[model samples]
Target: MFVKVVVVFLVMVGAALAFPHAPVQQPYYEQQPLMPYEFGFGVQDKYSGQNFGQRERSDGRAVVGSYSVDLPDGRRQTVNYKADKYQGFVADVSYTGQAHHPYH
Candidate 1:
């Protein structure tokens, strides 16, 4: 029993070592830049106390942008998006106005 266990352990270790692990590389969006079309905006309110902004770009290969706004109740909302030749568009949204739900 002891010998069999030792053999199995050694085999597992050998197999793991034989298959060398490779480091993961950055995603295409992170490495490549979207150019040829780029624009951005910013706005602020000193009297009413509100702000909003957006930035967008595309190069026929990829599109990326970010938008943010201030809510009337003093909450902020932001959304980010990215689209590339390889992987389509991906968006991430965050805001304080979102409804809360209890987890089951």
Candidate 2:
């Protein structure tokens, strides 16, 4: 019994020394810089009846934008939106003009 216990102890010690513990490593992350910008674009084709416009600006902390499109029903749909770290995202939708339907 004594010899068996000694042999088990020696085997455990040998295994521990044979495979040493590896040093732990922490994860690494790269940070990117943010820049402020503003841009607006629009398109209008009277012959094809396609009209749309969008304007947006970002100040690094918050973003605000509005887009308007001429819907097929003759009404124009406008959507105004804003987003930020504090407020999250919010949008207001509105429409203008009346819809007309032609019967065959």
Candidate 3:
């Protein structure tokens, strides 16, 4: 019983030292850009209405992405963009207010 207690104590100490005291929060958006390859998609944040999903072409000649962010005035803004060798770049933005709904 004494030996078991000592072993448990040692294990606990080892774990405490091996793991981080505060968990590291690396959002998916930040991680995607750091990868070796540039083609991927992820949602970086949700609560604040911030997220991005993007991808690059295999030939490296084009990229397409979309992102959304919440405004301070209780409105949400979204943007969609595309870039290619033929066309430099094009983007479209739309704003939606929480208080206004045309369909409803």
- Candidate 2 global CA lDDT score: 0.89
lDDT of each: 0.85, 0.89, 0.68
lDDT of 1 by residue, 36-77 (tens): 798999999899676999999887687889999987656678
lDDT digits (tens) for residues 9-67 of candidate 2: 99999999999799866544214444688999999998988899999999977899999
The lDDT leader among the candidates is 2
Cα RMSD to native, each candidate? Answer: 13.8, 6.4, 14.8
Q: Model 3 clash tally?
A: 0
Error of 3 at 81 (Å): 0.4
> Distance (Å) between predicted and true CA of 67, model 2?
0.4
Ordering by lDDT? 2, 1, 3
Better of 1 and 3 by lDDT: 1
Candidate 2 Cα deviation (angstroms), residue 22: 14
Error of 3 at 31 (Å): 27
The most accurate candidate by TM-score is: 2
Task: List residue ranges in candidate 2 displaced over 4 A.
Answer: 1-30, 102-104
